[model samples]
Target: MLHNRVPHILKRLAAIVLLGLACVAAVHAQDVLRVSAIPDEAPTELQRKFAPLGKYLEKATGMKVKFVPVTDYAAVVESLATGKIDMAWLGGFTYVQSKLRTNGATIPIVQRQEDATFTSKFITANPKIKALTDLKGHTFVFGAPSSTSGHLMPRYFLLRAGIDPDRDFRTVAYSGAHDATAAFVQSGRADAGVLNASVWDKLVEQHKVDPDKVRVFAVTPPFYDYNWTVRGGLDPALRKTLTDAFLRLDPRNPEQKQILALQRTVKYIPTQPENYAGIEAAARTAGLIK
Candidate 1:
């Protein structure tokens, strides 16, 4: 009976040791890379829209990349700040907020290569409206107040035109989504609105927005927009590996082509924090945040 009891205990101990080793090996195999991507616009199906890109990155970086899609722009910023996410794709407004709030927690890695910059267009219902001057005295709508392309840059353009966004327009409303803002103009609900041009363009590309009914009143000067942002203090080797994979994603490559379509870029361009100083200044001037 003593011998049998000893063997039983020894077998149980061996099993426990094997379990511990298996757990460690499983953790080591995961090599997880957590990522977050802002919905293209408010209330969008981000995971549904960007899943292909997430899968592409997983393969490219040889890690188990899990995409945490965010509908609220600000939440994405917070996630990056807390290290809940390893990387993110953010608009300029959220990016600026993340930088400031996270103790400079992240830096830009890439942006769309089109025109080598990103910009927004002011759309108006009146066909004759073709400049910022035309926006004065017209009822205006903007995307979410925190949106860089939809609100901050557009308001800056308004200021440049000698019209204070807070006081110049007959009425100002936030439609929350660029598509809705455009709809407001198309339906004659508002005279003009500011929207993320890339988002609007994608809608037009998808035939969701009528390009003929509402035309661009003005195209703001090119400024940075969407960027691939990664947390600071990331392991240097892993960082280099990931950045290189993104930069080298060729349009001809099937994996890259899908990512380019989602991001509206031919290829990712290397970028840094300083690249967004202008956007940060724009947000501050617009009084969106400190």
Candidate 2:
């Protein structure tokens, strides 16, 4: 009787182990879509805006969608490279760095189209300063030295105006985020700062910024900025599915429309890695990375 009972116990244990493995495999096979946002901007704001995007994606792909929140711009790159997240809405600069890290870590589906492509504001205080040339020898603030809108483009415009940011500015400081840079300027900590015009507009619309204290001191030539980037190495089919859903999302869809508004995007246009090569070149020229 004891021998018979021992065999029965072993058989039950083996069956249980096999069942667990099957369950694990089932979970692994389930499509789990993860997404995130660039830093400095509020993740919650993105979640609110992109919530419909996620729902649209889920409905389109028939997969479970997840949104992962990140604090800063670089984190989005790091997360996507490690496969910790499947997709992200990233800054152009961060997207370039992500490619460098994972070799082919990202695939961009859509890029935000602002009203103007050739000019973005460089906000400042000093009523005496009327143009980019007037910024010479004055202190300035730029967001994350790696920031595309906050630093790279702003620096490029400054250089175009014949000002070497590293040399002409009495001092240069990194406030780490556009909003922080705005705060620094608004509080008189810096003479001026670089920020996304959309972010500035939002803050102004919300009455968080006082237009009297800070003004657009200069505007940089418009260049591509933000996009929704899916991690590389994803199944080509899944990537295609997501890319299509994102691009096809209707602007009239109230949920997607609101999110697009926050992102300053009117539509999700198809883009490729090549679309951002100019941004990569700009980063290299600035020496932010090799």
Candidate 3:
């Protein structure tokens, strides 16, 4: 009888252990704040840029912050769509694509102050390519096909200027990244190329690319651009905490200043889906999204 009671006690202890494990598992499920950005810039540069921000987010959200790097623009969108990432830095076109992909389940929470009126630049080493019209019969490269500054808005402007990229250019190529677009034109891989003005400015600032070698020939009109967006089904409280953290990134603080400078923004501001209406319209007009 004592042996039988011992067996019952052992079964009871196992059940208690299993229940404790389940509770710990449930608590850990959302303990990590996994964030990623579109591969707009080089991977090394992106990592350098996100390092400070990741630390800042860890303090802000009280969760372990991790930067999940993606390989391309579409991967960012897909990651957000499938809940693979909690948040992402998305260009306007990519944001629209993600929102559409998830059936309007993503939220554009905040953006760099300049994103409200973002612009793109067309660059070239060929002196002959002086204007949008001069691009005729020349090889042209664009950033990722899903890029707002690199492709969609640039194409929209080119079309508006009566120069169809597909028909007018001798060749059309996708460099897949802004830095690569500048390199393509500077190295003569393409006669001309276009990239976001932010990247072009950064490259010039960093002396990474010679401005004289790959100079801007044209600039697209301003449009809505990049934003920090959260995936759908995120806990409303966590979403608010994240949004508040971004909104409250005070540049007066040294740590926050580093984060802002690395992000290439003076300050973060509240953003809404409505701000990107023009972007959605542009993607539709450019036939990038149905």
Candidate 4:
């Protein structure tokens, strides 16, 4: 009877052990990398741009990669703070908001080479608006209100030029995206508009907006703008893996080159919170932050 009881006990223990092992495998299977970006472009375009990069990230990290889309810039910041997402693509001003909202828990890990000196272009279809000063008494449009290149820095520069957008322009509008800002001006909805140079260059390169129909009104000087920020408590090892993957995107390789072109970057480099100091300062000065 004792020997029979021992075999039955052994069988029960083995079943428990197998259940634990299966649970571990299930947890590992659920370890997916969640990523998101600010809605700075049309949803479809952003999806198209991120497709190759997502595939590349999954292969590089040995984890399933998922792209979470947000409706607005603030949604990206909120998602990062609430831990609904693990990482995000954010503009400089949006990064500042996230850092503050998370009590400095968000980390900007990598930025494009061109991000070090990002610029905003003020474009217009109206021939009368040739310069910043000329925008007075005319309807003007800006990209998202929280945009570094499209709004905050552009507004800061406008104040520096003694042109208050709110007071100087007859009407001010938000186009919500760089491409839309160009369209607002081209369709005679607004006399002038501003957007990131990246999207502006893309529009020109793609002939999406005729150069003659919509021309640059003014170009802002260089400033730090966009970066890929991860949540504060992200695993260090995984963070390093993410950093290394972006750094490894070499333009010399054709496959990587296509990814870079889609991202509009020549290469990616390590970045830190300090790179966004001036952006924060500019936002504060522009009254976007209190």
Candidate 5:
């Protein structure tokens, strides 16, 4: 009986050791490349769009890549600053916020060709609304406050045109995303709305928004926008590998074309932190950040 009891205790101890080893292995497996993007669109749409791109990155870097989507634009900036994520796709203003929050530790790696000259489109259900001044005393909607093309530049241009959204509009609402802003105007929730041009074009192309109802009344001047940003202190070699992978995507290739079309980019190009200086200044002027 003593020998049998001794064997049972030994077996239990061995099992516990094996379990500990397995836990460590699981953790090591999870040491993957974590990626996320600002929720500029629906979370589900973001996940669908990123699935193929995540696979392509994994194949390129020889590491498992996971795409995480956040509900708000600020969350993406905060996650990148806190190192909760390894990399992020950020808008110009979001990148500016991350840079300031991280004391200029955030790095902009690549941006879409369209991003270099991005613009915002103001749409309205009211046919009489033909200019920025026409929005006065009408309900207005804007995308996420942290969005560059969606909110910052749009508001900046509106002010430049001598129309203040907050004061002039009967009601100012935040729609949280570009698509939602269009929907707001289409549904009569808002008399007019502003959003990124890329989303607006996509919506028009896909027939998601009826051209007969909501129409673009104004388009802001070109400005720098979205980019792929990585956390500071990342391995230099890994960063290079990631950047090269993005730059190597050939839009002519069938598979790569699908990804590019989904991303609304003709190609990805190298970008620097300096490209967003104007955006930072705009945010400061708007009193969005100190």
Candidate 6:
């Protein structure tokens, strides 16, 4: 009788342990979806803009959404590749990098309508700088070296126009952000600078940068740009859910409209890996990525 009782006690303990393991697995499955974006703007501004979107996503997906801010552009790519984050808002160039690093395991889900035809602006405080060619022999600043509109495409177009920024410019500086690039030029630390046209326009519209001090001297031809990318191994069902949530944002709805406007987008549209081929090609041409 004692032997039989000992066997029963062991079986009961094993069952209890399995039950606890199952509970832990269930809780992990419902863990909060972590999101992050390239530090293209001030961290404070990114947090402010993403807060409402996170709440909206939480309601849409029935999962808590937390917005994580990073210190630089590459951190977003690294986070997505290592599965540290569920999704990220990546510039075209950064998307290319993540795709390469993950061996195409990162997937693009959605992009703004504006992203399909994004452009960059070359700005300057000096009247003598009339064009990209004129930027030669003068100090110039670019936004983050990894930036698509702020650095990559702008450099690509400059090279196309026969101006090699590294060799031709007297000095080159990186401002780390579009607004900072404008401020750098305005403050005379740099004679000319380049940044995303949307950022430049916003700065002008907000009167954050005086028009008289800094003005657009050139605009790069349009190209594909920012997008929401997810890690490759995400459950297909969840990926579709995330994509659908973005598409559901209606500009006609005031609340959704505010979210879209804050993102500088008209509406979110589904995107595929092929959408970034041109961007990848541009990166290769610029020798930014292998």
* Model 3 ranges with Cα > 4 A deviation: 1-19
TM-score of each: 0.84, 0.86, 0.94, 0.91, 0.90, 0.94
Candidate 4, residue 214: CA error in Å? 0.8
Per model, state how many residue pairs clash.
0, 6, 0, 0, 0, 0
User: Could you arrange the candidates by lDDT from highest to lowest?
Assistant: 4, 3, 5, 6, 2, 1
Tens digit per residue, CA lDDT, model 6, 1-290: 99979989999999999999999997886578999999988888888889888888999888989888888988898899888899999999999999999999999999999999999998888999898889889999999999999899999999999999999999999999988998899999999999898888888989999998788888999999999999979889889999999999998999998898889887899888898899889889989887
Query: Taking the tens digit of each residue's C-alpha lDDT, what string does model 1 give over 17-59?
Result: 9999999996774488888876546444566556787777778
Residue pairs of candidate 1 with colliding backbone atoms: none
Better of 2 and 4 by lDDT: 4
Please, what are the lDDT tens digits per residue for candidate 5 over residues 1-290? 99879989999999999999999996786459999998889988898889889999999988899887787888898899888898999999999999999999989999999999999999998988998888999999999888898899988888788887879999999999999999999999999999998899899999999999899888899999999999987888989999999999998899998888889887999999999999989888877888
Q: Write the per-residue lDDT of candidate 4 for residues 197-250, one digit (tens) a residue.
A: 999999999989999888986899999999999998888999999999999999
RMSDs, each prediction? 4.0, 3.2, 2.0, 3.5, 4.0, 2.0
lDDT of 2 by residue, 26-108 (tens): 67756778878876665566677667767777888888888888767777888999888988877788888898988875787
Best candidate (score: lDDT)? 4
Residue 11 local lDDT, model 6: 96
- Whichever of 2 and 6 has more TM-score, that candidate is 6
* Deviation in Å, model 3, residue 252 alpha carbon: 2.0
- Candidate 1, run of 10 with poorest lDDT: 39-48
Error of 3 at 108 (Å): 0.6
Using lDDT as the measure, name the better of candidate 3 and candidate 4.
4
Worst 10 residues of 6 by lDDT: 25-34
List candidate 6 stretches off by more than 4 Å. Answer: 1-19, 22-26
Poorest lDDT segment (10 consecutive residues) of candidate 5:
25-34
Off by over 4 Å in 5: 1-31
Cα lDDT for residue 112, candidate 1: 70
